[model samples]
Target: MGSFTLDDVLAVRKRRDSWWTVFLVDPIACRLALLVANHTSITPNGLTRLSMVFGLTSAVCFAQELLIAGAVLFFVSFTVDCMDGKIARLKGTGTPFGLWLDYVGDRLRVLCCAFGIASALYARTGDVIYIVAGAGVVVLDLFRYINGPQLKRVRDTTRAVARENSGAECVFMDELLGASAPGSSTEEVRREFERAGDEDGRELVDLQRGFRAQFPWYDRVRMFLVAHRVRSHLISGIEFHAAVFVVGPLLGAVAWLWTSAVSGALLLAFESVLVYRAWLATREVARAVPVNEREKVLV
Candidate 1:
C-alpha cells in the first residue's frame, strides 16, 4: 500500500521480546513484514488468518508423525505470527478484535499441536505417558494464560486503589514493570510515562516496594540481565512452546518428554517467584491503604 523499509518494521517490533523470539523469529519476521507492508494490500488480520492455516497444517503434519516437517511448518507459522503485530503497529491497523483474534489463534494452535503430538506419540508407542504429557502441555498452557492476566488485573486494581487512598508517591519500578517489560531503569520508565501521560502511567508498583525491601538482591540480578537486553523471565510461554513443539521434534521422539519437563519446571519456578513477590507487596499495601474492593471481596 505504501513504501516501507526493514527499519520501519524493526521500529515497530517490541521493545523486549521472549528470548526465543529475539534469537530465532525476529530476524525472519521483520524482513517478511517489510515486504508485506510495502507490497501486498494484505491486512494484519489476513496475516493472522494465514498463520492459523499454517499452524493447523503443522498440527496435521504432527498427527501424521512427520515430526521434522511438523516442526519446520510450526516454526514458519510462528514467524508469521510474529509479523502480524509488527504490521499492525507500523500501519496503525491494530484493533481490539485483532487482539482477541491473535490471542485466541495462539491458544488454539497450541491445543492442536499438543493433541497432534500426543496422539502421534501414543499411536507409535502405545504408552499412556505420551498421552498424559500432551494433556499436561495443554493444561499447563491454559493454567499460565488463565492465571497471569487475572492476577495482573487484580494487582492493577489493588495498586490503583492503594495509590489513590494512600496518596503515596508514584514509583516507576513497582507499577510500570507490569505494563512494560521488566528490564527498564526507574528513571527511564518514569520519563517514558510522563512523556506519554496516559492513565496507564503507574499501576504495578505495589510489588516493587516489597521486593526492593525484602530482596534487595533481586534488582541487582534483574539489572545484570538487562545489561544483555534480556528480560529476567527466564522461561516464558514462548520457550515452553518451542521446547515442546520445535526442539523436541527436531531432536527426536524421546526428547520431548525431558525437554518439556525441564521447561515446565523453569516456568513454574519463575511463576512462584512472581507470586511470592506479589504477596510481600500486597501485605505491605494492606497496612497502608483504606479498604478497597479487593479487600471487600475477601471479607
Candidate 2:
C-alpha cells in the first residue's frame, strides 16, 4: 500500500526473467544496441519515436500490398520495438511520462495501421469484409489495453481494501510459493521459500520454486509460442492485403473466400484467447502486495 514508482514496477518485471529471449534469438543483441545508444547520448523516447516511424512505414507498405517490403519492414519495426525499452533501462532514464507516451503511441500505431490497411484493401477488391476484419483487429487491441491493467488495478485495489479492513494483509509471496503443481522437486521449492523470508511461508515457497525451476526450458517454449503466434498473424494480415489488393483482379473471388474464412477465423480465435489472458493477468496484478517500505502505505 505504498506509493509505487516506475523503478519498483520495472524491478519486479525484470525479476520475472522473461523467456522471450529463447524465441527472440538475439535478445542480448538488442541489449547491446541499447548500450551503444546510451553511450551516444540517445534517449529512450527517441528510440520509441524511431520505432513509431518504422511501424507506421510497415503499415503503409502492407496497405499498398507490397508483400516482401511489408514483411521486411514489419520485422524491422518490431526489432526497433525491442530496443526502446532496453535503451530506457540501460541508461536509467525510464520516466513515467515516457512510459505513458510509449504505451499510447503503440495503441495509436495499431489503430492507424488497421485503418490504412482497411482502406487500401477496400480500394482494391471493394470488399467490406477486409475492412471489417481490420477493424476487428484494432478493436481487440484496444480491448487489451483497456481491460488489461486498468481492470486489474480495480480488482487489486478492491481486494487490498477488503483484506486490510479485516486485519489481514494478503502477501503475494505466500500465494505464489504455496501453490502446488504435479512433478515439482522439493529442493527447488525450498529455495523459493527462503527467498520469501518467512519461515511460516517457506513450505509453499519451496513448492512454487520447484515447479518453476523444474521447467527450465519452458520459458523458451513459451517465447517460441509467442513469436510463432505473432508471426502467423502478421503473415495472415499481410496475406489478406495481398489477396485484396495485389491479386484482387485474378484472385478476387478466391481471395474473398479465403480472407473471410481463414484470416477471420484465425484472428477471432487469437483475439479471444488474448482477451481472456489479459483479463486474468490484470486480476493477478491487482493481487500483488506492495513490498517496499519507503513510500507512504495506502493500507
Candidate 3:
C-alpha cells in the first residue's frame, strides 16, 4: 500500500468544510479514500456511482427495519461520498459533468432515505405523521437548494459593489462567520471595512455585520454544517438518520419517531428564518446599489 498522511487528506478539503466532516467523518473517510486511490484504478466518478448504490441499498435496509444494516450502509455511502471529491482532486480529473452527477446522486440519496424511513415507519404503525415528517424533509431540502445559491449571489453582489466603490478587497461572509482561510489576516479584513466610505459601500458592510449579529448562534452551528453543498439539507438528513439508526435502537422506536418529527419541525423553522434574513439582506443591498448595478447583480 502507498503511504498517505493526514496532511495529504487535508490538502483536498475546501476552505469552508462542515464541522461534522472536518472533525468526525473526514479523518476516516479520507484515509479509506487514499488507500483505495493508491491501490485501484477507479476514477472519481466511479466512486460517486458506487456511493449511490450504497445509499440506495441503505434506503432499502431502513425500509425493512434492518437498523444496524441500514446504518452501516449509510455510513459506507457517506464515506464514499466524501471519497469521490478527494479522488477527483488526487487524480486532477474533475469535470463539470462529474459535479452535476454527484449533485444528482445526493438528491436521490436523500429522497430514497427519507421515503424509505417514512414508509417503513408507516408500515409498522399505520400513522401519517411519519409520512408528513418525510415530506417536510423533502420540502426543506428543496428550499435549501433553491435559496442557498440565491443568497450567495446576493452576498457576492453586495461585496462586489462595495469593492467597486471602496476600491478595497472585502472579506467573504463565510470568513466573518469564522470559516477564515489560513493566513487570512484580521487587519486586512478590518481595513476593507474601514475603506467603505461611500453610501453603497457602507450599506453593504452594515448589512453584512447585521446578518452576523442576528444569527450568532446559527453562525456557530453553521460552522459544523458548512462543508455540505446544501448544508441545511444535509444536516436534516443526518439528524433524521441518526435518530432512526442510533436513537431508535437505543431509546426504542417511539422515541425515534417523536425525535425525528420534532427535529423536522425545528429545522423548518430555522430554514424559514434563514430565507427571510437572506431576503432582507438582499433587499438592503439592492436598494443601496445603483439601478444599473442592481440589474447587473441580478444577472
Candidate 4:
C-alpha cells in the first residue's frame, strides 16, 4: 500500500536464516525489498528470475576463474535470492510456482556454481582433490535439503505427542521459535520470550524434553544465539553454501577447500546431534504415552 520501511521488509523475513544471510545479505536485501515493494510493479517471481540470471552469470565468472568478480556476483546473487521471499511476504503476491521455482532454482544454481568452481580448479591445477571436494560439498548439500525437513517433521511430531501425553497446553517450537514474526529481529524475539505463558495459551519454553532436558549446557548458548538472531544450530546448510560460494571465492582455493570441508563436517555433526535428540525424545514419548493411558484407565 504505502511506502514500506526497512522494518516492514524485515518483518516478513524468516525468523531464523543462515548467519551469513542475517549479517551480510539481509542489509542489502531488506533495503532492496523495501524499494521494490514501494516503487516497482515487479512480482516476487520476477525477483526470483532476476536472481537466477545473476547466479548463472556468477557461475560463468567462476568457470573462467575470475575469482573476484565471481565472488562479488555470487554474493549479489544470494542477496537478491533472499529478497524474493521477503517481497512475497510483504506484498502478498507469492505464487505456488514461485515457491517451486525458488526451491528448484536454488539447487540448480548451487550445482552450476559447484561445476564452475570445480571445472576451473581442475583446469588451473589438475588436482583431482578439487573435484572430490566439490562432489562432497554437493552431496552434503543434497543430504541436508532432503533429510533436514523430514527430521524437523519427525522432531515436531515427537514434541507434539510428548506435550499431549504430559497434558501440556503450550506450543513451544512453532510460535516464538520458528514462525516469522514482524521485524523478525532480536528485539521481537525477546519480546516473544517475555510474552510466553500458559495463562494465555501461548508459546512456553519447553524444559520437558529434547535438548532442554538433556543438554543443560546448551541453554545459555541457545539464548545467546536467539538473542543475536542467529540459528541455534552451530553450522547448517546455510553456512555450508556460504563457505563454498562466498568465503571460499574471496579467500582463495585453499581456504575455499578447507572452509567447505569444515562447514560440511560441522553441518553433519549438528544434524547428528539433532537426530540423537529426536530419538531420545521419541523414546520418552513412547514410554510416557502408555503411562498416561494407564492412568486414564485407572481413573
Candidate 5:
C-alpha cells in the first residue's frame, strides 16, 4: 500500500544480484558499458533502442536455427538491458520517459524470441510444447508487470533507509539490492548533498567511492545481475533454453524415451526456481509500509 518513487526502481535494480549471477558469469562487464553511457550523455531510451536492435538480431538468429549465434547475441542484449538504467542513475539523468521506453524494449525483445522459438519448435515437431512455452512466456510477462508496483515499493524503502542511515554501515542482505534507506529517493539525497558544504558533499562522494571499492568487481557484478528485478529474466532465459531447446524438443527429436524423462526433470527444476522467485516477490510486498507512512516520510 505504500506510495512509490524512483528510488524504489533503483533498489530493485540493485537487488538483481540475488538471482542473476548464478546463471551468468562475469556480469561486471556490464558496468563497463554503463560507465561509457553515463559519461557520454546517452539517454536510457537510446540504450533501450540498442538493446532492442541486438535482441531482435538474437531472435532472428534463433529463428534461422542459428542457436549458437542467437545465444551469443542474446547474452549481449542482456548485458545492455542490464546496464542502461545503471548508466542513467550514475549520470543522474533518469527520466520517466526513458524508463518507460526501457520497459517496452525489454518486453519486445523477450517476447519476440519467445514467439520465434515457439514457432520454430512447433514447425519441427508439432508436439505443442513450443506453443505451451510461448503461452508461459506471455504469463511471465504479465506476472512481471503485475509485480512491478510492489517491486517499486521495495526499491523505494531500501533507498530511503540507505540515505537516512548512510550506506556505510549498511549490510545488504541477499534479499534486497542496496543498503538504501526505506523511503529515500535519489533526488532527496542529491539535494541534501548539494545543500551541504563543499567538504560535506565531497565526503559523501568519497563514501560512495569507498563503498564501491569495498566490494570486489566480481561480487558487484554478481550482485548486479542477481538483483531481484532482473533475476527472473536470467532464470527464465536459462530455463526456456535448457528445457525447451536443449532437453525437450531437441532431445525428443534425437531420442523419444530420453526426451520425456529430460523434459520432466527440466520442468521440475525450472518450476521450482520460478516458485522461489514468486515467494521472494511476495516477501518484498509484505515489507512495504502503508501509503500514509510513505507520504509522511517524503513530506
Candidate 6:
C-alpha cells in the first residue's frame, strides 16, 4: 500500500469517472495494481487476459447458481480490468493492440456472463423469460459498443474543425467533453477551448460548459455511469451479476429474471442518453464548420 501514492491513484484515474470507481473501486484496486506493477513483470496485455479469465470464471459460477462465488469473482474481474490499464501506464507499455484487446475482452466477458446466467436460469426453471432478458442485455451492450466510437468520431471531427478555424495548437475538445485520457489537465482543456476564434467553436464550448453548470447533478451521475473509455460499456456488468447471480439466488429464480431484465433496461437508458448528447454535440460542430468544410472534415 505504501508503494502506491496519491499521484499514482491520480495517474490511472480518468478525466471523468463514475462515482463508484472514483470513490470506491479505484481507491483499493489502483494501489493494489501499483504494487503488482512494481513487483512483477506482468504486461498490461497479460493483465487483460487475466481479467478475461476471471470474468469467464465468474460467468461459470453464475451459471451454477454459486452466488457468493460469482459475486466475488465478478468484483475481482472488474478490479483487474481497472488494474491492467494502470499497470500499462506505469510500465509505459500501452499500445494500440493492448487497447484493442481490452475493449474486445470487455465485450466478450459481458456477452459470456449474460448468456451464461440466462442459460443457467432457463435450465433450472424452464423459463423462456430469462433467455429473452439475456438477449436484451446482449443487444443493449452491442448498441453501447457501436455508439461509443461514433460519438468519439463526431467529437474528434468537430474539434478538428474548431482547431482549423481557430488555428490553435490545443483545441482540447477531449477534455471539455470528458473524452480525454486519465490525468489530463482540466485547466489546460478549458484555457484552450476559451481561445476558440469562431462563433461556432466558442458556442459549442460555451454550450458544454453551460450544460454542466445547469445540470450539475445529472453531469455527476452520468460521469459515474459512463466514463470516457470503451470499457464503460461494461458498467452494468457488476450490477447485473450482483442482482441476478447473488441476489437472485437468495430471492429465487423470478427475482433473478426480473433483475436481469432491469439491468438491460437501465443500460439501454444510459446508452440512449449518451447517443442523444453525441448528436447534439455533433450538430453544434457541424453548424460551426462551413458546409463545404464539413463535408471535407467529417468524411
Top TM-score hit: 1
Of 2 and 6, the candidate ahead on lDDT is 6
lDDT for residue 82 in candidate 6, whole number 0-100: 86
Give the Cα RMSD of candidate 5: 12.6
- Clashing pairs for model 6 are 18-224
lDDT of each: 0.78, 0.49, 0.66, 0.75, 0.51, 0.65
- Supply the TM-score for candidate 4: 0.83
Which order, best to worst by TM-score? 1, 4, 3, 6, 2, 5
Better of 1 and 4 by TM-score: 1
RMSD of each: 4.1, 10.4, 5.0, 5.0, 12.6, 5.4
Candidate maximizing lDDT: 1
lDDT of 5 by residue, 1-299 (tens): 12323443344355434243333522553444445543465666777788789889877876775656666776677677666766666456678888788777777876776676666667777878667766676565556465556645644554454344432222123232333333434344444454563545422322122223344453344344433334433334344334433334343333422443454455446555444443443333323434434343232
Which is the winner by lDDT between candidate 1 and candidate 5? 1
All candidates: TM-score? 0.86, 0.58, 0.76, 0.83, 0.50, 0.73
Q: Which 10 residues in a row give candidate 1 its minimum summed lDDT?
A: 198-207
In model 5, the runs with Cα more than 4 Å from the true position are: 1-16, 21-28, 34-41, 148-299
Q: Write the per-residue lDDT of candidate 2 for residues 167-275, one digit (tens) a residue.
A: 3333333233224232333344445545564645322211112223544654344433343332212333333333332333234434534544564455457546444
- Across residues 175-197, which tens digit of lDDT does each residue of candidate 6 receive? 45466434445454455455554
Candidate 3 clash total? 2
Question: Please, what are the lDDT tens digits per residue for candidate 3 over residues 113-173?
Answer: 7788778888999999879877776776676677668767766776677557545444445
lDDT of 2: 0.49
Residue 182 Cα positional deviation in candidate 1, in Å, after optimal superposition: 12
Which of candidates 1 and 3 is the stronger one according to TM-score? 1
Per-residue error (Å), model 5, residue 18? 4.0
Error of 6 at 174 (Å): 8.0
Where is model 5 poorest over a 10-residue stretch in terms of lDDT? 202-211
